[model samples]
Target chain A: MDRKAGFLFLSALYITFFGLPAASLAAENICHQQGLEIRQAEIRATPPNAPVTGGYLHIHNHGTSMQRLTAASADFSGHTEIHQMILEAGVMKMSPLKDGIEIAAGGHIQLKPGGLHIMFMQLKQPLAPSDMHQATLTFDKCGDVPVLFKVTKTPGQSDSAGHSTGHTHQH
Target chain B: MKKIIIIAALFIVTLIGAYSLSEYIARQLYPQNTGARMQLGSPFNLTAHTGEAITEQAFQGTPSAVFFGFTHCPEVCPTTLNDLTNLRDEVTAGKKTFNIFFITVDPARDTVAALRDYIPYFGDGITGITGEEEAVYALARAWGIFWEKNNITESGYNIDHTATVFLLDDKGYFKGTIDYHESRDIALKKLERLTAIR
Candidate 1:
């Protein structure tokens, strides 16, 4: 084969094998919504027979107006709800909010351990490290933003895509 | 060469059989307790969230569900309590009699008044209890409940504890613990099975 033809052939192979897959992966990671960004989503680890598990994330408001995140859903559970973790008289108390969590323009809300977060209730089955669950976060303004939550062995461990920090130990 | 191959195949088969048999025997000798099939029985008593004294005697002739958690716990406590609320509703709809109890390990912080407000948040007829540390410890030990105080700083401390919901028959003895992550239906089914046993 001619040198020029060989070089063209190699370039075509590289694009087909590497470039296309990388582009598709990037597209899969992208959120469908324009102004909403999910940062640092994580799920807590508990024993097999435990009743409940927790999820944490950071939501940034990139739009011009304020937005309210009212509800969340995980495919693994029957339902998910937003909860606030409060310390009353030195005891940590968690309460559910009828009204959804709000993020003002240019402001961000953090869902971390020992604080406000989401609770996955009535798990259909035991969550394993190999599993990846998808959740749809519904907002008043931004509409429904579908997020793929990657299950981890513990909190603070990043999902399979390796974007955010995992669990944090409260000392 | 044929003899050698046959011998190697036989050795491999023997090794596989040995491994499978050992695993099966080990499982039989020490069965794994998934905490799913266990039934929780009750009868221990302590102070209520209303600061009123209560005893297992008060719940006599009625089945009750008991959960061991402090009010300060953010995740497990509330979620379990909420599940209990749903469980109570389901039981009532089925026309069965049942009571729910929340025993606080952090009595120092979770006062009866606090429990009164907290317990009722999930549902009505739920009782929250707190007592002296030694008394609570004694009850916890008897039930095989495990807990430890952690993150003690200059200002405060956090506790790490076992999150088990104990189920009690009308007679108030430990029947078994509800699996921590069981669905409301599965848990209700287990409760029904326990209550039906004569």
Candidate 2:
């Protein structure tokens, strides 16, 4: 615990001295060391004036045992929930998972549209595709996994196959 | 007796083949006639995001895609809406009138502003409509939509409703329904058929 605190203190100082981008990368690397791995983390950004958005990412339990992402916190919203979307009896049902979802040993779960996802409600402001945001996911055993959520263009949308518009966030 | 048995077998095969062909032809000729299984639509009234009173009659003269969902949903709503928007963009050309109607079941919270900001984000020619719970419920019932509130939260609740996108013709007849979760190519084919047949 002391070592973790020391690392966070150094990271904060690094951010203050330099900038957020490098510190963000360093923070992600720190999160990777904590045993919970996040891949392809993206936040869906809509048009202006919208107050909320959805987030998707792949969480892998790199540790030898199972890990549970018990809760998640974000700087942008007051509330965060792990929700499930399912189609039952011809009805599309979206409901929150009261008991957090589990990541099996040596396995992973994908938080995606039309399946499981994270809901960020009461956003401080609208999410723009050009912007990046930070979210911290808490695990049952792995502690805090801070991630830099890259804003992706609206899900299930893109230009024609050949008529390509360049991605805004290459880095 | 052997000749009679052979003739009888041939006759049965021809009869079955003729029945199958006729059934195929009937489906093609009367594609809008979903009356055989379930009726497609009925009268509905609601307020559009633009704050104008609208009804089922407004969709009478243009091919429309009707879907029922809530604004606060995490995925299916936006994913399906994006898929439908892409289908519309793929099928529409030269001022073809293809309208998409998004009806919210959670009208208590899905206000005009919420929908106004949400629906247009998908694509143009789409209208977000909501109203009193009774009004929205009536519309859902008429369209054979099964929607109910579940997972209630302090902020709001998520709605369990049909995710199928109904395809209606210019005459307000039920042509068919495209399950939005289906592959985009399949949805595109149905949309293209709706436009080409028009």
Candidate 3:
């Protein structure tokens, strides 16, 4: 979790909503293996033919017991799912977790944009921030990692591989 | 130990049958998902990413802000159209003249040039409605709105909507609904009570 203090706390939230400098998209956001470390892995662009896009990252875990992330894969969208965005009675719902998202043993989970996201879904093309995708998360015991996704354009712009409180683009 | 009370009574009857089948499929696909205050969102004739032909009586002499997202919905319809264009630029900072309609309940992939290249990036006054899909499903069934499209063997098969952001009035009616889980000071006090009606 000391992963460069999570990309220096997501480059101070991409200098408060895209003043840029997510440190060149979080210094080449990696997929290193140590106890699950994958930070600043963005996606967000979608609106030139939008179909679905939103994947933010930060996984930490420094290992001990609890991990789970279950699934996620990408070669530039078709279906990725993970979604959370709660709120319930006050409305704002967005469900689809289907058993994945645990973390807790040492703890760390971010995946921003309105709360725990990843949903790349069906977007065959058009997600430019000059594009650069990869995504591959699956973990129940730290197996698949993949990570790369760095196409920022607002929505928590490029933390590339680090940050925490996702308020990166509220309007 | 009687098999721990028969495995805690079969885990409380499978957690009440998965909470009454997910509360009856969330009351049959979100009956306004209970945040209530519905009714009012009819009358339509979309098409207006600039090609004109809008209606609901040009938002009838003022007070507007209808939203029923799409354009591939990459996160709660652009975070509920950037929280209704930041409560319509903090209560009409353009000296009052609100009018936020962004219709398109997926008008066959939001055409009209994809809502004129997507509602000017949540700035400006914002107006983007796409037509014909039964006139955007009769303006999304007079606003009870609830899209579906679901998992369809996956391939980006996603649609599940109802992100709310209503608040019309000025004779267009339905004077409620804010939820993007509220707060922009409760959605600018519900868009200052719908631009103080009238």
Candidate 4:
């Protein structure tokens, strides 16, 4: 009994000291490869019959050369494309980016609502809240960056992110 | 004395012309409010998500919040519907009977089955409307709503549409509109005032 009690105490101490911080760190949802970092990666949960949904994230290129995000593939979607949604004079217009997006050296690009995002078309199944999806984002220079997107009901309501769609970065 | 009288007459004429021009500009700019209690839509037949044939009479008894969008829409439609759900809960508090409608612009894709599965994700009491393309277009035209489809990929398309939510009174008269991305506080207040109308 004493040995089991000691083990449980040690586990609690370890969780308080190490596990909690890791949980807090997960709020950023970042993936890094070859000096390219993707932050706040998430996919929006959709209604069961929705034909399409959006994935948003921020890309930071720390390398000295420009990188082009050319393509993306999601395990849950049959077709994935980089698309842009423009809200001009209360009209929302969306179009695909044929040439992909360019990230300058030491510059940042954000894929957000009312702006650039990943369009997941023909979903194999409906994405539910708290579900994690695996997607591979391919870049010209970085090859492929694997990311895990946390499915959220609202745009930025995952973990402690607390960033709502209403506050998406507007540029 | 004659010269003074002529100058006063010219000054009065300029004032009158300026006033008339301003009034004309106001009327041109805000034609929605100028008409006598703007009529919302003409009689039309459409299928609800419940698979029932409905007409404008469905909106005649209770104040309705109608939004024109499609299930394929990724961002705006879902966000607006979610916002409306929360706002309705807060504004009504289970006391008011407010109706919400989600009318699809892409009628070809948003069939009865499609909407039946989609509308339930949002809060309850929202009726999804879709019908033949021509009839849906006619209904949108009557409400002064605009929608157009743009082909991005060979097999995929997106729509450019008005994201405004139209508010109608219990008598089916157009009351006002809630613009997309309008402040939440203001939208809540608008719903409060709208539901208060009898």
> Which number leads on TM-score?
2
Backbone steric clashes in candidate 3, count: 8
Ranking by TM-score: 2, 4, 1, 3
Name the lDDT value of residue B92 in candidate 3. 75
Candidates' RMSD to native: 22.4, 8.3, 22.9, 8.6
The better candidate by TM-score, 2 or 3, is 2
Computed on alpha carbons, the lDDT of every model, listed in order, comes to 0.66, 0.75, 0.71, 0.83
Interface RMSD of each: 12.3, 2.5, 9.4, 1.2
TM-score of chain B of each: 0.72, 0.77, 0.32, 0.80
Give the worst 10-residue stretch by lDDT in candidate 4 chain B. Answer: B30-39
Instruction: Compute the lDDT of residue A111 as modeled in candidate 2.
Output: 78
Per-candidate DockQ values are 0.03, 0.37, 0.17, 0.52
Question: For model 4, which pairs clash?
Answer: none
Off by over 4 Å in 1: A1-36, A39-171, B1-45, B153-155
Least accurate 10 contiguous residues by lDDT in model 3 chain B: B30-39
B153-195 per-residue lDDT for model 2 (tens digits): 6765666788898887777676788885677788888887776
Residues A89-130, candidate 4, lDDT per residue (tens digit)? Answer: 767888889899999988899887668999999888999987
The clash count for each model shown is 23, 0, 8, 0
Task: Show what share of the native A-B interface contacts model 3 retains.
Answer: 0.47
For model 3, residues A12-121, the per-residue Cα lDDT tens digits are 78787774334323332322333667666778777666777888877778767777888898876767778887644433456678997998877888877778888877
User: How good is the docking of model 2, by CAPRI class?
Assistant: acceptable
What candidate 3 gets wrong by more than 4 Å, as runs, is A1-60, A63-71, A74-107, A123-171, B1-53, B56-58, B67-69, B78-100, B104-108, B111-128, B131-185
lDDT for model 4, please.
Answer: 0.83
Better of 2 and 3 by DockQ: 2
